[model samples]
Target: MHSDRHEPAPLRVELAGARLAGPAPVPTGVTASRPAAAVPHPTPTQPLSPARLDTPSTWPRRTLLRLVGASAVGLPVVAALAACAEDDTVHPPDPLAAQEVLARADAAAATAAIALAPGSHAALSTIATERTAHADALRTEIDRVIGVYGDGTTPVHRTGALTVPGPGGSPVPASEVETASAQPSTLDGVRDQLVRSQQSAAALARTESGYRAGLLASISAACATQAGVLLT
Candidate 1:
């Protein structure tokens, strides 16, 4: 049977003067003879470092400069597109220049009626009045197309001269001189001439549009009606 009690510690003493005493016995559960070994230390874990922001690798300086140069070169091309868009908004060309020949036929009718139409008063006056009205309408339209009003003091760029074809299919000058040079004829010849001229006017009206076209068409109808009256 082993005893349950722990053993008692031994006493220690030192001798004076001559020599040192021997080491004493150590107590239970206590270490007095040997030095204690150094305690083991725990190592601290290191914190993770943040990632570096590399600018040259992401978008190099050369690449950035190239992008800027490309943008500069495209600016004029963009401006030219804008200019073409503005030009497209300008007005369309005029369609009335060919009708200037009507002035000559109108003058010739006025001249022929006085010598050819068989009446001293109303019949002759009616023919003269219709031709005069047609001439006045032509002049007004000419002024309108040229952007000149009230006697036309200043003329714009003139309309190109009309190619007036005669009975022989030859080109004639569309002038007052051509009208004045026309020879006098009998009443039936005058009626035939006026009817042909009015038919030509009707054909011209079909080529035009808007208010000017309407005016021309009305004049053509009036001329036809007046020419028929001469026949009766």
Candidate 2:
């Protein structure tokens, strides 16, 4: 009798770099194998360095531009403030400025008086001499107070020669007397000028102290004597 059952077909297997043909039996009671759990690789770390640590590199372009612009603007402002601080020095006006002007005017008036009244030459000459002396003394004091530079050169004065009212009620430089072509002033006009000068000196003396006050007081007394006694 012929066999009723047929043998199983041959099994073919494929593997890496190899091939096999055989009647391999399928194993029972074995669990299917899963591919080994894929392992994750750690990311590489960069070394810490100044180039890597610099935060400005990470700043936004707009933010970096703003900071640079601020620094540029602030530098000029700081320089300007420094310059202003250096230029803040102040020079006060000289105290004897008005007195010097008055003395010079008195001298001119006394000299003019002599020319106007030849009969009173003796008294007028004395007055002119004394008045000129007062002007010279005042000028000397002013120059001494002004002081010289390191090179023995006198500094440029801020105060210039002031003007006084002339006999014609117009202003003229204190250094110059009105010309004869102008309105001729009488002895009474000279006396009036002396009186004003005396009053000015007396008023200023009260405000001053020390040597300056004494000088002004002496000037005031001399002017009073010339106006009240000499001119009379």
Candidate 3:
């Protein structure tokens, strides 16, 4: 007697580049289905054009105008900021400048006093010499603070004054040296000016430090002696 069970068909694989022997046979009891439609692949997009990379004309008009406007406004602001930075670095006016001026004025007043009152010649002469020395010392310190460049040239500063001019753009003439209140003699005027110089120097000394403070204090003491002791 023959068996009723059927054997399954063997799988067939075609080699690459080779044709199939014939169409594959469908298994028994399975319905044959139609082949699925081929799916079309999307087309590849082309790369950006190299010629358009630097072409401003290809850019939007509004975008180009905005960029140009930003640059135009930004450049001046940057320049202004640079200018402000430079200004901040600049040295401030030296405090010693006023002291030097006071010293010179005091010396001039002492000299004028000598001519006005012949009896006080010796004392006035000594005061004038000391005041002149004080002015010179102040000038030396100012120069030292300004410093010199690598090329041996002095740094540019507003403190350089070959001659300290008095009020009205001239040396303190004898006539202008007179005090506001009428004094009996020129010695009184000299003494008053010395007192003012001493007070100014003493006040400034309190604010200064190091060598400058010591120097101002010494000058102030000297002015006090000249006004209170020598003049009297």
Model 3 segments more than 4 A misplaced: 1-91, 150-152, 159-185
**Candidates by TM-score, descending order:** 2, 3, 1
Q: Name the TM-score of candidate 1.
A: 0.48
lDDT of 1: 0.58
State the displacement of the C-alpha of residue 97, model 3, in Å, after optimal TM-score superposition.
Answer: 0.9
Model 3's TM-score against the true structure: 0.51
- Taken over the whole model, the C-alpha lDDT of each candidate is 0.58, 0.70, 0.74
| Candidate 3, poorest ten consecutive residues by summed lDDT | 8-17
Backbone clashes in model 3, listed as residue pairs: none
Per-residue lDDT tens digits for candidate 1, residues 27-81, read 7998676768989898786664333334446557668888889979998777755
RMSD to the true structure for each prediction, in A, is 16.3, 14.8, 11.7
| TM-score versus the correct structure, for each prediction | 0.48, 0.51, 0.51
lDDT of 3 by residue, 116-150 (tens): 79899999889989999999999899889877655
Q: How well does candidate 1 score on lDDT at residue 9? A: 22
What is the Cα-based lDDT of residue 29 in candidate 2? Answer: 81
Clashes of each: 0, 0, 0
